[model samples]
Target: MNAKTPDTPIVIIGAGPAGMAAALALHTVGHTPILLERYREARPAGNILNLWPPPIKALQEMGVDTDDLGAPCHTTFRGVKGNIRADVQIPDDVVKAYGGGFIGLLRPELYRRMLAAMPEGVLRPDVEVTAIEDLGPTVRVSLRDGSSIDAAAVVGADGIDSMVRRLLWGPSERREHKLHIIGGYTFADVPGVERNEVVLRHDRTVQGTYSSIRDNGRDGIQWWVLEAWNPKAEPPADLKSHALSLARRFPGPLAALVDSTDQKHFQRWPIRDRKPLKRWSKGRITLAGDAAHATSPYAAYGAGMSIGDGYTLAQELTGVDLTDAAAVVAALGRYDDRRIAHTTAQVQQAYVLGKVFHHAPAPLRPVRDFILDKTPMLQKQVGEKSPAEIVAQLDEMGAGLVRA
Candidate 1:
């Protein structure tokens, strides 16, 4: 096949946050990208979410209006007794620039903002990509409709069961954390709820937490309760009641938040993630978001990291000639080098946290709690290390998507 032209466009599969961000970032960097979503429209898979500073910066750089996007929250890890175990201290300048240490909001609002900023005709819905072939200078993507298109590159932003990832790297087992989370949001006035704060509390076994959220100028709170669950077992028949029961274990307005939540707002997810791959790109094709690194919610940065992936990918691909196989390979290799180590650390950390918090032995429960309460280990790990990483990412992202 002849070398593809620059106008051939980079094809991005999936329309989730990662895919949409990729399309926006790629467009910002002067690349023509086609975003394909199997579904009729781009939709959020869950409701409640939080984003750190790095993603906020990425959104702004991609031309998405970050003003009043979400509730700015000062997050703290606390015990059931309300004693703060660790305070996530993001730099004041970062908090000011990005809105807060962590921005809490409903997932759908993020989708709406990203979708609004998406270039017209960039996203093609109801188009299912069935196969991908890296043909030296270009990639040919076959659709379920028995049609095909050639692209300069293919980015798989598809979710956990990513077909692109499977094609690049062989299938790997989904490592089930054997944990479940029941989450919901409420716009009603809940008494005793803290404003603009993320109160994450843990009791003996269950983790009940709530964060302030703002949706289209309406202020509210989003909460979730996570516990060890049998992966093979059926979900609770009454999710609200079960969440309420767990919420009651924590001292605060968590239960009130749950009670105020409507039935329609409730959501549940069984936590699972694939092992991080050592490499994310091969030839003219690469991976992004959950396709590259499926993460447990314990990281709270899954979506944030996915947004960062698109931002970073665009930066690496800028000024590179896509028609040249060597140039494409080199650019994708740089993407892998920049993303792999950081994502792998986050994935492993989230997995270990699930094991430590919910799956610890009964006899070690008190010991674990005592250590967490008495020592600065959690403080150093989450409060310090996490912020440092976020700052580092922001630095690495530089001034904008396109290099000066």
Candidate 2:
């Protein structure tokens, strides 16, 4: 077992939404934390966005201002086929009821806001962590720089390829991982689109959608995302060629939008998912965010879950007796248990949604429309009800989450 030269009380690996959020939570509880990251700075490739009701309220309490980079979008549009459907008129109060307002922001802008909230010396970037050794009560992390800082606990908030999770789980866990080099460039003055709304255009062989970013006071910038699922193959080498082909799938003014897009300005990312790890806590170390559980974008819960992980983990950690290692581990167990149920439901539902709603089926379109028409609450239930409630609803309806 590797041991550490005792350092900070807590050290979070990866300084993205989850890591930063964890630091913020620690600060609120009056605990100073140390954060480390391999990237030079926070990566804001995706249009930063969060839709959950709970965390928005927490952010308000934290007093972190994001008005310069974020906006409350009251209207949302979602549906399928060559049709317009499901226009949701969510009022500000209604949005707040969920937890916080339905807010959107640029990723860089949000990163800036999070940085301002933390104390100096807490955030460390551009340092790559190579390994984590579970040394009984605490974990000893070895960094590429050849120096290490030990902590009472280690957080695996690093994105999909988390180093902490790799060591703790070993290299053999069958958590299916895949990479997708998808890109999105910010564009101003996109025509025929409403702000604060996401518009999806379905092509039988492909799918296209544009979601609005928070108001930057200029013309709003929208992200056009393309997703293709292929498990065994590697991402294409020629990004522009593949991007152009992906762009061609969308007709109407979108072709022009894609043409106007700077493929070079686009953000590409690999995709990975864990089959709900057996446990998130091993003694004093625990997993948070993607390291603990990564969901497919089909659920759009990555950011939400990251924030939730930070929120709940903080709540549990602050309440637990930190002096007692067993007590600390138990508190983390609660964090893991809570996150697993919440995230697992999302992963399963997202896989089902990708097939049912995303796929353009001429035969099933009418039936889907009819089902949606009959029970708009099926979608409603998923959002308004708890995860346990969602499972119960599925049982009551004699329905089950679809498999990939």
Candidate 3:
């Protein structure tokens, strides 16, 4: 077997959550990793966000500060009339262990914390990876500036339109969910808003939801409305007005929260993701995060899963000899085996949920709502099963980032 140079670093393309986490975790595992970003600085793509406990634990183990990172929320699915449809029942022990079951925080704050924990000189901004090739013993990453770096392994942590993914597994069409979400956050002390809770409500055709958020020691709330929309159509002229109109459909402080949000804090996103790839690694290169499995936000675990990917990748490569082609391939195969199934399940579930909630037939709307309201189907699927799956990762993570 060809041997790689020990001094060659593992190169990660993209400085998003996945790339950054991978670099940190790799460092924890005693590997030098170079994180490259195409942008001038690392930034989050969206504002409103939530994260499950697995990712939280992963972040903390990687040395990112977890003290009051976000508001701890008891999330529940509700009908538009304020009746609880399904309660997310995360175990109390898990909640206590991770600081919260599902955390509510601004995406930028998360970026800030992760970036703060990042080691200096690891992240190279403004250096775009234009091409990647596996050369048996080493992988070569060509930059936009005509320079190239050779590494023992390369991780494609780039976003949905990942160049490494395209190079490794050809191009695949994006799967549009035909839905859009308008969301925003506010620090205003809006009356009638519940604290420390995520109230996700759905009407016949729209989903209006809000959750408590804590940003930098300040208590606040974040809200969003999701509905079917044509991907090609122009966005609403007035985003706040449109969001407020949707908020009005659901009872309680959703509308007021929307009204209280500053125009600068509001944002909109069209939901889309690519189909899950059957394989993510080939030779000395592998994929992570959206590059491996682009998922819709309906899962609310996209970023969480991305962080988990980095942590898991680091674990799989902990003591493996990166120089040995067989060992590197075996390590990557383990990473794929561990990540693909879980992330793919999430991607498919989120896609199906979007279709069911927003794109369902008009005639079947009442039938679906009635089932969700009366039956334990949703509770079984989302409330119990989903939490079980998420919490299981904590155990699977096996103590910490560094293997014993």
Candidate 4:
């Protein structure tokens, strides 16, 4: 890729949750990893993230105090035409058993917190990785500034449109699901909105919700609108107008919130997920987070999975000789084996749930609502995980990783 370089055993691309977690993981194992990001600074405009317990626990182990950023929330689902469908409350006992609670925090705050947790100078912002070469014995990562670094291994933690993933698994191999989503956040004095509750309204192609949440000790609201539409159809230029148009069909308070939200805070983008790849590693190169398993937010597990990947990867590489190419390959193989199942299940579920949330054809709407309303168990199974099962899994994941 470039002239011979000093051995930087691991080079992590991207500074999002996955990359940051991987850096911390490697550091915990006594490896000083070089983390690179394309942006000049952190872009934390993804609105609020609903991080689950498993990943929250992992972040706590890495020294992040999520409790301050978020509080536990009970989720509700509304059917077509703003009708209540089902509600899923995370029981206190389950929260106590898992030792972590489901939380919502502004994505920007989480991003800043993660960067702050890293050692100074470990994160190289504004440095873009132009290319990567997985040499038989080493990985050469090229940067936009005509510089390169050789590492025993390279991590493709770069987001969905990951350059490292493209380098390893050609562009044609990448895939995206057919879903469109546009939404944003704003500070509002929503009188009736409960601070500890988030709601989702599934109304045909227009499916979304707005919730009151605590951010930096201030009250704020976050909202989103998702729809199953033509992938190639152009998105509306004015997201605020689009959200407002959809809001016309929403309940009074929900519509008012959308109408009152500032146009500057409205963000719009298509929801895309990568098709499950048969493999996530080649030679000394491996992928993590969105680069490995980009999923639709409908499942709300993608971020958690990314953080877990980094933690589990660190666990896998704990005592392995980084210079040993065979060991690196074997460790990555195991990482893929461990992660593929969980992420794949989430991807499939997100796709299925996206369909369920959107219009279920004219004749199926009533049936869909009936089942959703009658089946508390179904909602429970979808959103609630057994605390005992979660704790046991966490114990398994924490077993091999080096402690902080």
Give lDDT per model, in order.
0.91, 0.62, 0.91, 0.75
Would you list the rank order by lDDT, best first?
3, 1, 4, 2
- Kindly list the per-residue Cα lDDT of model 2 for residues 18-129, writing each as its tens digit: 8988887776665557888888987764653545444444443344554444555543324434454444344455455442245555667667777888778888889888
Point out where model 4 deviates above 4 Å.
Answer: 1-7, 80-84, 89-100, 173-176, 375-377, 384-393, 399-401
Tens digit of per-residue lDDT, candidate 1, span 172-228 = 899899999999999999889999998999888999999899999999999999999
Model 1: residue 8 alpha-carbon error in angstroms: 1.3
Runs off by more than 4 Å, candidate 3: 1-5
Worst 10 residues of 4 by lDDT: 383-392
Compared to the true structure, candidate 1 yields what TM-score?
0.98
Residue 366 miss distance in model 4 (angstroms): 3.0
TM-score of each: 0.98, 0.79, 0.98, 0.89
TM-score for model 2?
0.79
Deviation in Å, model 4, residue 69 alpha carbon: 1.5
Candidate 1 achieves a global lDDT of: 0.91
Clashing pairs in 4: none
Residue pairs with backbone atoms closer than 3 Å in model 2 (clashes): 53-98, 53-99, 53-100, 54-99, 184-267
lDDT of 3 by residue, 123-189 (tens): 9999988888899888988888888898999999999999999999999999999999999999998
Clashes of each: 0, 5, 0, 0
Error of 1 at 368 (Å): 0.8
